[model samples]
Target: MKYSYYALFTTNNQGRIEVTFPDLAPHVATFGNNLPDAQRMAADALVGYLLTAESLGIKLPQPSSFQDLTPDSQQRLIPIEVDTKSN
Candidate 1:
């Protein structure tokens, strides 16, 4: 199955990109060296999170619309795709 989620991407002082998913509470954030790396890291983070949620019988929350999110100067909303089938 394919899952869609809104991710918040931010650039830290260290120049690493930080990714967070607001809809998933107690969620883990990941960092990458750059944009493309950050995006890939986000995908891995989501997959690992979801797999753990599944193993624990935790139902994943429905994703919020990308348009509904408000990002500050340090953050931006990004649409991400997760394919559980491949996991």
Candidate 2:
């Protein structure tokens, strides 16, 4: 199965790109030194979250529409996709 979600990328005070999935949970977060790295980490984080939820027999939440998100200047909304079958 393929899962898609929007992640918020924010540059923290430490200059690291912090990634968070608002549609998921507050505890779901990842970080990287740069944009590219952050994107990769975001995808990995999303996959891990989804897989873990599946393994625990928990229902996943529906993703929010991109248009509905309002990101500030310090944050960017990015789409992340993961295929469980490939993992």
Report the alpha-carbon TM-score of model 1 versus the true structure.
0.91
lDDT of 1 by residue, 1-87 (tens): 788888899999999998998888558579789999999999999888887887899878788986778889889788878887799
Task: Summing lDDT over every window of 10 consecutive residues in candidate 2, give the lowest-scoring window.
Answer: 20-29
Top candidate when judged by TM-score against the true structure: 2
Candidate 2: residue 40 Cα off by (Å): 0.6
Clashing residue pairs in candidate 2 are none
Quick one: best lDDT, which candidate?
Answer: 2
Alpha-carbon lDDT of model 1: 0.86
lDDT of 2 by residue, 1-87 (tens): 899999999999999999999999685799999999999999998898888988999888899998888999989999999998899
Off by over 4 Å in 2: none
Clash count list over all predictions: 0, 0
